[model samples]
Target chain A: MSASSRRGVDVGALVEQARDGSPRAVARLVSMVEDASPALREVAATLAPHTGHAYVVGLTGSPGVGKSTSTNALVGAVRARGLRVGVLAVDPSSPFSGGALLGDRVRMQEHATDAGVFIRSMASRGHLGGLSWGTPQAIRVLDGAGCDVILVETVGVGQAEIEIASLADTTIVLLAPGMGDGIQAAKAGILEIADVFVVNKADRDGAQSTVRDLQGMLGLGGRYADDAHWRPPIVKTVAARNEGVDDVLAAIDAHRAWLEKTGGLRSRRRERAAREVEAIAVAALRARIGDLRGGVALDSLADQILDGKLDPYAAADALLAETSD
Target chain B: MSASSRRGVDVGALVEQARDGSPRAVARLVSMVEDASPALREVAATLAPHTGHAYVVGLTGSPGVGKSTSTNALVGAVRARGLRVGVLAVDPSSPFSGGALLGDRVRMQEHATDAGVFIRSMASRGHLGGLSWGTPQAIRVLDGAGCDVILVETVGVGQAEIEIASLADTTIVLLAPGMGDGIQAAKAGILEIADVFVVNKADRDGAQSTVRDLQGMLGLGGRYADDAHWRPPIVKTVAARNEGVDDVLAAIDAHRAWLEKTGGLRSRRRERAAREVEAIAVAALRARIGDLRGGVALDSLADQILDGKLDPYAAADALLAETSD
Candidate 1:
């Protein structure tokens, strides 16, 4: 017990190292979280006091919408201000996709040698809710490591991305010209979640109309029914050339200011924490149910349902009762 | 006690009508399941005895892969064989997609007036796991409605589609020429779950190369290392023209035969039922956790985590204990 070999590390020392800006310690902590290691409990306990400082900004859009490029540019801009940054590229795990999008990582090569910037790509191990269950924990690791800002980039087309949006202090929804993204954005309900909108590849055709279309849709959304509301601002950039990235930074800072001024930061963080706690609780319960599979309980219930002797809801009730026992 | 008004539905009568071929009744049952109405327990019970007769085939691909058109063509082919068909368009619900893909439904208009066909569109309603929690219940509804074959169509790019694939007896993964879908398919991990592959838009220039790319990948996958292994066969079709659809149907039939001969059908259905039951149980548990939000227990735990007094896992453990109590 005194040795605590299961964790295989001095968690207190690791947390101290992270707080003092050791990128290796930060990466190791994040890997522990990402892998859902048993050591996570101790790590999180150690990390608690060191968190609550980093601002999490989420960037998401369609696959070809320059999200990675924009994120790269944002990292450069953030680093220019002498602030440390962390990037978590949360790729929705495909049972077959096998790994993270390597192409997207290539764009971040510019920051590979910068100790002040930490970049990690995570793929869901097909855990209960894909990456959602583990993502918040990873963010906490970066926060504990003293990143001034953390950027979470994910493809914005699924429920997981929506969950990521709720976890963010500010969310940037990127669109590019000629992707039919304006209509697609509206169709995908991306508009409602955006704290900031970026039209990347601004040099491309129809960039202006893309912006106008977003403006038209926003006008129709009634998102700003009063002065207290924050209407998402749209910025255009050719992210490949690092054009207009500072404007993106400005938009983020402005949103952050609004969040702080309105007490939105505290409330949003509280909501994020609530959801994170709920997700963990649910995942743990799910694992208990999975444990039932080793016994005959779940199989028996499934057989009953298949045999038409019981309804699923009743079977589920019985299973839950067994779980409680 | 004799009248259960909460359901606003006579579960027994509804199930009876659904079994007797009333599309309206089937639609109502599906709606109950989709809406997660209080009556669902009774509905599932009543429908349980009447299901296990439908062969569920899942169709999935990226948005532009002509999934709806292919589904429409297959419906025609099946209808021509004089078998009743059910189509469940399980659209992954976007918070703001507003509704199902209306354009996809337009292609199915050819079967709208046919009594032998039943089609319904569903969005996730943002339930615990999105559409997944409700989908199997809805499929049971269709099976009880006397459909001989059920086609579940979904966009194949996300975790939800992967879940849909697991529910299927025979899963058909669709692709089109010029979409760079070969690489996308590999990247998305669509290759692993498919029992059948359809290369639509065969007249397009890149179609043959697409087929070759798929064959090459499949060979590299070592999916058929033994005689007992089932290799997914690729079928090319001009679905809009109703060309080569029969071959697609042939591939489906062959797979179905193989599944039945090897007792794979029973095991697959059992797995599907297990997952369905698990999803429902988890959703119930999640909802219970949500219910805690109405009290101070969850919020208090969340506050402690935010204040760095407790880690999320410990909070989750406390929350679970409270739930059990």
Candidate 2:
């Protein structure tokens, strides 16, 4: 109940420290969220009252869209407004580079001395596939810690990047000129996810063409959108030069204001919470089932499949029956 | 049981017709698989003995890399060898296009009159996010239907596309010139999934550079490959003209040879089967839990979270406890 040893800091003390804007305490809480620690339930209980104050923004696009640069730029802009900011970069470390990407995102280091900014990267270290499971919970930690806004940046590649869209109140899909066919952008479902589209590296040739292509694709209705009735505005930016970053921020602010005015913000947040609840529940059940799989029952059911005795759905029913209680 | 009518198409009858190389019957069986019909388990049992006969190849790339053209070329090559082939193009119909891309994949129509080649497209319709649940089971139906080779082509976008890499005996990752930053290839986890790399539209400027860039990146060992120590071969193809198509096929053949020679094929297939089995099981349990959610129990638990009485993980545990039986 009191501030004790650093190693065994209790949930209440850690929450207090995090709420007081201690970066170390904030990092520790997020780490706990990532690990799905036993203390997570207690931590959630403590942070409950303080949650939902922070606005969440998800920035995603094809890798090389300068998502990190834009995210860094946005953090700087937000911090300038005197609002505390948290940035979660999912898998910022490239396994192919042996983590050399750590040095490439120099703009992040430029703000290392700014206590007003908190930046963290959720790398896919040992995660073989899918986004990290702890992301939603970690966002909660940031929100509950009293940040004014949290920016989640993912290298808009892979299937998991879509998670960012569902979790964020506003989603910014970034693109770069000459980066590939505009059709690929539509194929990736980016058209459906963009609340705001940023054509980064606007100085590059074909930037206007890219914007036109995106707009043309958006005009089509086969795609999904958070607001089917609201048209997404495309903003051009030279993110590397920190040019037009403020306009992107302004678009976000405008969208947020509209959402609140229309009461869409509250509903979106509720849906987000519902999704989080469902995902957590399913993951837990999967773990329990995984534990059962270590025994002979699952194998036996699978053996029945090999023997052509039972169908997969029926066999799954049997497995669930055995493990449910 | 006899196939008296469409409604009464027995699993046994469909399997028999499909095994006899009837494309109509094969398509029907796949549809059942996709629908997750109650007969799925029964169908799996029926197909189990005849399955594993076809060599499965997965071709994936960011959309607009001429995947369909390349696939059409592969089918022609395989048919030239007098072997029957199956092609599954995942998301060939864009949700935004209302399946207009189905018409756009005109190269597929070139093989329309070829009895030895069967081509079908799976659209992304209402799949929440991630790969559709039914893809693997559909593959089983094709394999059991006596196709000598089956090609699974997915627009290299979204989380589900990774499923193609996992399911295929050999995975060919396609890329084109000017498709964005070369470094993004590494970050997207694409580098790790490719068994063979194909730089399509090889006549375009930067085609060679893309190849050089890919080779340079692959030179980096921070990747996971089917053969941990084996290097992936790169092939260049002007697929639109059908030039170098044979060379690309040669690379596939070469990779297949290496896999078979090293017993990598057997292990890869086993892993594929394991994943398929796990996915079906998980999907079934997800369905069961989804049904439970239709009742009040889940809502009450959610209410507890809103009231600050329970954490998500704890509530999930309680939900599992009540439903395990």
Top candidate when judged by lDDT against the true structure: 1
**Regions of candidate 2 where Cα sits further than 4 Å from its true position:** A1-31, A42-277, A288-325, B1-9, B36-41, B62-64, B96-101, B125-129, B158-161, B175-189, B201-228, B236-243, B303-311
* Separate DockQ for every predicted complex: 0.41, 0.19
- Give the alpha carbon lDDT tens digit for every residue of A1-325 in model 1: 4233544777788889988888888888887877677778788888887788899999999889888888999999999999999999888745432266476557788998898999888776565566567788999999888899999998876776677778899999999999999989888888888999999999989999999999999999887723379999999999989999999999999999998888888878888888888888887778788899888888888888878888889888887777765
* Tens digits of lDDT, candidate 2, B1-325: 4333355757787789888878898888877765667677777778877776789999988878888888888888889889989887777335442264466357688888777877776654434233435666777788788889999888777565577778788899989998863676777888888888999989999998999899889876644445445678889898878899888778888888888888878767655554455666567656656776687777777666555566666767777776665
User: Per-model C-alpha lDDT, please?
Assistant: 0.85, 0.75
Docking level for model 1: acceptable
Runs in model 1 with CA error above 4 Å? A2-4, A12-27, A46-269, A289-297, A318-325, B1-4, B60-83, B91-114, B123-131, B154-164, B173-227, B231-253
Q: Which ten residues in a row have the lowest lDDT in candidate 2 chain B?
A: B124-133
Tens digit of per-residue lDDT, candidate 2, span A1-325: 4333344759898899998989899989887765657677678778876787789999988777888788888888898899999888776445442243465346599777788888776654334224435677788789888889999887777665677788899999888999874877778877777889999999999999999888778776544435435568889999878899899998998889878877777767665665666676667656766786677777676666545455555666776677666
